[model samples]
Target: MNEKKSVTRLDSTYMDQYDAHVERQGRKKKRLLRRLALFALLTLIVTSSLAIYHVQQRMVYAEKKEEYEQLQEEMGSLKESEENLREEIELLNEEEYVLEIARSNYFFSKEGEIIFKLPNEEPSY
Candidate 1:
């Protein structure tokens, strides 16, 4: 009877140790799951922020592209005007074209030509 009682006590101690080990493993598993959830939440926030930043950058780029196109069109118009002015300058270098310009712009006349005077219109103000 004494030896049987000793064996029973030893079995109970072993069972208690096994139960403690299983409880410790359960706690560790819970901690791991919590850490994984936190990591997933942080990753989601970072990805969303980066996506918003990229979208804002694209909007800014689109506005700048539109401005660049408008500026290019304005430059093209100015270049055409410059080309027209250059041709006019070349034409004005000729004596006949210069004389015509002077006559039209300055109302110049030959020495023997008669000048006509017109009455000015009254101001409304």
Candidate 2:
């Protein structure tokens, strides 16, 4: 076992006042640190939520943009089909076009007209 010397302290009004002041300062420092920590946590939570919201909005915007492009392409194709159908309707309204289709498909003949079926053969080159 080791022996240690004990020291004696003087009791005075100045020492007591200084100790009280030191204790008050320590408490003030602790309160300041706690406030700073709480503020930092609040800032982190707000920033994280904002970042997540920003990312989700960007994804929704991208999907909408892609859908709009697809719809535009489909609209173009539909417009082309409508134009083709209109042209076909005009053709079918003509008497000559109707007669030609009947002559070709239904073996129809005008006066002194002959119909022949020829073999479709490829020549070996």
| Candidate-wise lDDT, in order | 0.91, 0.96
Candidate with the greatest lDDT versus the true structure: 2
**lDDT at 22, model 1:** 100
Model 1 vs truth, CA RMSD: 7.2
lDDT of 1 by residue, 46-101 (tens): 99999999999999999999999999999999999999999998997899999887
The top-ranked prediction according to TM-score is 1
- For candidate 2, the per-residue lDDT at 96 reads 99
| Alpha-carbon runs more than 4 Å astray in model 1 | 1-11, 115-125
1-125 in candidate 2: lDDT tens per residue? 68797888779999899999999999999999999999999999999999999999999999999999999999999999999999999999999999999998899999998999776898778
Runs with alpha carbons beyond 4 Å of true place in candidate 2:
1-18, 123-125
Question: Candidate 1 — worst ten consecutive residues by lDDT sum?
Answer: 1-10
